[model samples]
Target: MEPMRGGWAEEAALAHLLAQGYRLLGRNRRTPFGEVDLLLEKDGVYVVVEVKQRRTGRFGTPLEAITPRKVARLLACARHLLGRDDLPVRLEAVLVHGTPEAFRLEHLPLEV
Candidate 1:
């Protein structure tokens, strides 16, 4: 997909999270090494969510896009976010795709 399409997918992911009762803390939060797509707080836990969206299966599914390296970046961002004595947190991924009215959400919770 193009850059603009990717941006819209992210926006749609954020909206989906909000609709699911996540309290948005930040978006595209940057660190010295990487950036986090969404920082959310829910049920008293800080959630570092990586949003993935795919239009077709020719390449791979969105979930397959997250690599160990990407998880490392997410961990780094979570550490930065936690430096302020915030809530206990975990790393997660939100896979979003499908029609606008029927998107998919896969919350793969990581132990932290």
Candidate 2:
């Protein structure tokens, strides 16, 4: 997706997460491994969110975009940001489908 569209999707995802009571810690955070889309904290646990947006389902669902490699990179980046691997970290995905004005989003916990 285009950067502008990606930004819009991220903004939408952030809003959704915020409304769900997840406090924002960071956005587009970069580490040695890669960039983490959103870092959130809720109930004392760190949430590493991967925001995936799809305008259409021609290719696949937004959640289908997440690959094993992507998960690994996200994990590495999250651990790097926290400076430890033992902390409670949860991987999640904010799957958005449709335009910014009319989108459906689902928050799902991702398995490590």
RMSD of each: 3.1, 2.0
Per-residue lDDT tens digits of candidate 1, residues 64-94?
8998888877887888867864558778887
Query: Which stretch of 10 consecutive residues in model 2 shows the poorest summed lDDT?
Result: 1-10
Residue-pair clash count for candidate 2: 0
- Best-fitting candidate, measured by lDDT? 2
Off by more than 4 A, model 1: 1-3, 84-87, 98-103
Q: What is candidate 2's CA lDDT for residue 17?
A: 91
lDDT of each: 0.79, 0.93
**True-vs-predicted CA distance for residue 111, candidate 1, Å:** 5.3
What TM-score would each prediction reach against the true structure?
0.79, 0.93
